[model samples]
Target chain A: MARKGRAGAALAIAAIGSFFAGTVSTILVAVFAPPLTAIALQFGSAEYFSLMIVGLISSIALAHGSVVKALGMVVLGLLLGLVGTDIYTGTPRFNLGILELSDGLNFVALAVGVFGIAEILRNLENEHDRDVTIKKVSNLLPTRQDWKEMTAPILRGTAIGSALGILPGGGAILASFASYTVEKRISNTPGEFGKGAVAGVAGPESANNAGAQTSFIPMLTLGIPANPVMALMIGAMIVQGIVPGPNVATEQPALFWGIIASMWIGNLMLILLNLPLIGLWVKLLTIPYYMLFPAIIAFCSIGVYSVNSNVFDLYAVAFFGLIGYGLAKLRCEPAPLLLGFVLGPLLEEHLRRAMIMSRGDPMTFLNRPISLVLLLLAAAVLVVVLLPSIRKKRDEVFVEE
Target chain B: MKSLSFSSRDLICGALFIFIGLFFAIQAYGLELGTALRMGPGYFPLVLAGILILLGIIVIIQGTQIEHEPMGPIAWRGLLFILPAPILFGLTVRGLGFVPSLFLTGMVAAFASTRMRPGTALWLVGGLTLFSVIVFSYALGLPFRRFGPWLGQ
Candidate 1:
């Protein structure tokens, strides 16, 4: 019945709906405190890093596309993470002298632009053949049976995510991917894995947010920044002339505690914010296609421009947009490209730091047991990917859309 | 063996990826490529470009080797909605501010059916704008400019 209505409306509603949910969820993690910090400290470096590995594996495994494609994306993300300040030399890596990018592309801008804009383009491109009408949406909430199906996956995901959160490098994003993989691997109804499985959405979401909340513990308590966000927090601390260390908890209890407390507030706010917004967002899905496409482009530009209030970003967005469109036509997933862009500098920095620390010794990776293990694991991943049996399974999984 | 096929679409895409990769690789020559074990600034990008080229080649080969779905013609009308939405949002940022601009953008982006009144779009615009303001501005403290003199401040 709704499909009889309009395409533009549906696309708008879906996009806005997802955006609202994601924003609220993220904000909630930002506000919460005691429990959040307590959660973070549970995982240490090894588990965190191991969980990261799990995340990489899972994200690659669970991707809807071919295994090779997914792995490519994972590598791309890792590569992008590598870009930026070299740990040893403190040199700017890939900013290209664009002030906005000197700090690297903002996640919000990238996320909003790539997914949001790209999606709008796709919808508009099919506007003529498509009816701008509504598809009848099913009942919003999960049924009892749905809950039963989802409950186990959610629990397993939570466990996996929480455990991973305890480790050094593992975070919410990783947890989300890892949970999805675990769900797929262990599910009785494995075939239903990617067909809008509520378990797929729910477990990963819960795990991702929970992991995000916990990632801060090591940063606040142990003074080791686990990821970019944590690094930002460290920057905030340094700007305030506070040196972060193991004793930070004791030395600045209020600041630490206050931030922690804020996280809870954020989380509560998210629940309140997201639930109601879902209705409004769903309602948006009723709009027509003609008016929707232009608006998405406008938003993309606005989002990009906000990064530095510069026109250059507009040009960059256009450039990337064209590139994005081209890649889309090719069936090359842009996710990996973005990932590579993000990680490129970071990877460089880490490799450089390890090398300098080792005094130019190539074997320095081996000297650090943790680093050695990581290297070995990376190698193993490559080897496994090359194995014919695994290769066949991977190829089978990535159905071309 | 099942039949393998490559559409014209696949060929075009492969060519573009390879082109971009080559461009990046060439530009990277100016930047230090760093050492084998110790990475420099250009190392990741250089490697990424190489991989992208390789992937492009693989995609081209795979496209050639597989049975594929037929793609439809370019829907030029659809481009109007998709292209303009984001650009307008950016242009109006400083003038209308985040909330109002968001409202306008959201409204413009939404397409009500001929049977539906404009009021539906209005309501959605109002609703989404308000929610974004509340969540991002009030809750997350994103520090976006509100309406009036505070614009871009």
Candidate 2:
């Protein structure tokens, strides 16, 4: 296996690039895509439902696990998503009789609980005193040859990131992950992947960064949020008395252009901040887990509690964190579950709309051209998963990294 | 070992899936499924649950058929500390406020590890609580209390 430190270093730096890159890109897409860049504006409910299904399929297919477990996780997520008040009927589905749950479980708290707090619990399983090498601070820069190899992957990653970022629910995380898989497959030395191949870092970093920037396209132009973050942005714009959608390009030209300018500035700031921060960030890895975990808990508790200033959110996080730990033990990856959770409401809404539009005709999904095409693509993904050669390749790519 | 023997991991996973799938399907069965076109709230969930149950049964069959890798012992230690830490924070946050709740949560969570020293845990709790209070309460201007309910915010 590749040494943990080396891989951690690469992922950490790449993560920093990705986090801001998304924020910047989302802000800029409005300015750059003059016409508001929404190819999916003509999307019908059938097409929208098909698109969400595609997302569900990709999330499961991309993750490493038995099909049953992954599907179960997705179903669980969807069920959880249905917990809030149903929009059409004004009836709460699964609020467990708690008034606090009327609006559904808080997304931020749930994410923090599952990904962050649960991760800490997992780490504590095999916890050991970390060996600190304080005296030997390694060179942060890649060698000359490293730069040469990284150039192509970075470009490829950027391109992929930009394209996928515009797709609803295909955010920076998916872009980076998909980029890494593609990079690993195309690399000359595939065996070097788990061992911290520089390309693994470079490709994903660039892709995630680019994806983060470009995902704003649908939000800016069509005003349909492609991801949860975009949903928040749309909410913010609405609150600020700015009506998003196609007319924003014509009515609010200056505001659109200004946001784009800020995206570039944000990117510049990220680069400046990252270089000096690298050393300090790496130093974090050397801290022993016991000291580290409590601190993580400290931050998580405060953060979860602060959201809506609701203590119930904290309880929700705790519950989810426990479930997360159980799922982790079962090797049911949570990433797909998370994506499913985020997309669940949309999926249901689209399905309901499509059904209503079609007057209960189940064949509508098959009949609609765009919806049929998306379903075909989803079918292709399933076929690819079942293929023995692709399965082997998936195994190779799905290692500890 | 033959490929047909039950694998512990797959069996547990399969059973869990089957149980959850059945639960949702049965519950939604009571609700109006409507026609496929009209699509009641229960329709989509019922369809998904059916698929899930089918997949679960497949996994169960696979479990019975295959020899599998051994499952790891679940870390009860980690679960004990990590699970309740947040609930404690929840119960206390409103009455005690952010600072004390976080500190207590951290201290309780610290013991999840057998290796944690009280001195280090104390320091960590203190340092993290202080930083968060300043950053979250002071810098962010969050309306939640640093100390409230008992102290009257």
Most TM-score-accurate candidate: 2
Q: In model 1, which regions exceed 4 Å deviation?
A: A1-59, A67-108, A128-157, A164-303, A382-401, B1-13, B33-44, B71-75, B78-81, B84-153
Q: Residue A219 CA error for candidate 1 (Å)?
A: 8.4
lDDT, candidate 1, A31-86, per-residue tens: 54335455435643333343344334433433444445555554554544544454
**Tens-digit lDDT track for model 2 on A278-395?**
6766677666767778878877877777657787888888888887887887778886677666667777888888778887787999998989998998888767777878877777
Score residue B118 of candidate 1 by CA lDDT: 79
Docking class for model 2 is: medium
In the order shown, the candidates' DockQ scores are 0.25, 0.66
Which residues of candidate 2, in runs, are more than 4 Å off? A1-38, A129-135, A141-153, A164-204, A215-263, B65-67, B151-153
Model 1 DockQ, alpha carbons vs. true complex: 0.25
Candidate 2 chain B minimal-lDDT segment of 10 residues: B65-74
Candidate 1, lDDT over the whole model: 0.55
With candidate 1 superimposed using the best TM-score fit, by how many Å does residue A236's alpha carbon deviate from the native? 12
